[model samples]
Target: MAFVIHMPLTNTKAATRYAAELPMRETSPGHYEGYYTATSNVRATGATVEVRAQDDYGNTASEIAKGKLNIN
Candidate 1:
């Protein structure tokens, strides 16, 4: 499934400089992977994973994945 992850933005400067598009990789049919490396080390709180899908006709849709991230 295609997904969008909204990682919390901590550093204002980094947030402002954040890339507008995430470079996604296709793992399988209709599945994609993307990653973000924080400019600084920080913990994640209330993190969530969002999935999106689009058709050749230019129609699109999205949904949030189930689960939480535990970084220690």
Candidate 2:
């Protein structure tokens, strides 16, 4: 099985929920989902999301999602 991790982004509040490595639950095989309410407001381009994954075999992969923050 593979596990996913979300790296938290630093904020002005010293540390928010995004300040630690949050793990996403594997809803189904190979599918993971995570839900979190924003603790503070973010500008249209002020948010960054990083995703990482590791397999039971010790293989690891990571990526920083590149996109504008959609404040709607």
Candidate 3:
């Protein structure tokens, strides 16, 4: 099983690059999605997902999501 992460980008000028600690998927411009697949042998409890955004002008922003999912 896989958990999907959705991060919405409201401000464009402030965010030019998107990166996630997990695998990153670009659903569209300025939008990103990722999957949780760490510790395949153990069940995933409360996990934290971080999404970072950086602009060319050196501005940056980040968002974090924490939740528990059944992935056994």
Candidate 4:
């Protein structure tokens, strides 16, 4: 499983494939954590957060929390 956060730009799409991606570490079974440095180039309110989870069988599921992020 993987967790990712997309920087919210007012004009950018929620699921941008070219945006900066965070690498996740599996702390425990079915648990994950990811960290990224905040840069002056990216900041917004009501941003988009995307999570992509996968199983041992390579089955992947993706979920998006749109317009629910606030970055400073």
TM-score of every candidate relative to the true structure: 0.60, 0.56, 0.46, 0.63
Model 2 Cα shift for residue 47 (angstroms): 1.7
Candidate 1's TM-score: 0.60
Number of the top TM-score candidate: 4
User: Model 2 over residues 1-72: C-alpha lDDT tens digits?
Assistant: 222223334446567564556668889887887654544754334455667787779898877767634443
Off by over 4 Å in 4: 8-20
Arranged by TM-score, best first: 4, 1, 2, 3
Misplaced by over 4 Å in model 3 are 1-20, 23-25, 36-39
Pairs of residues clashing in candidate 4? none
Q: Quick one: best lDDT, which candidate? A: 4
Error of 1 at 23 (Å): 3.9
In model 2, which runs have C-alpha deviations exceeding 4 angstroms?
1-18, 40-44
lDDT of 4 by residue, 1-72 (tens): 455665532334664555555667889986788775556666667767788877789998889855587776
Q: Which stretches of candidate 1 lie over 4 Å from their true place?
A: 13-21
lDDT of 1: 0.63
lDDT of 1 at 72: 36
- Residue 67's C-alpha lDDT in candidate 4? 57
- Kindly indicate the candidate among 2 and 4 with the higher lDDT: 4
lDDT of 3 by residue, 1-72 (tens): 112234322234454245223446568986777654334344444544556666679786776655644444
lDDT of 2 at 43: 37
lDDT of each: 0.63, 0.56, 0.47, 0.66
> If both were scored by lDDT, which would come out higher, candidate 1 or candidate 2?
1
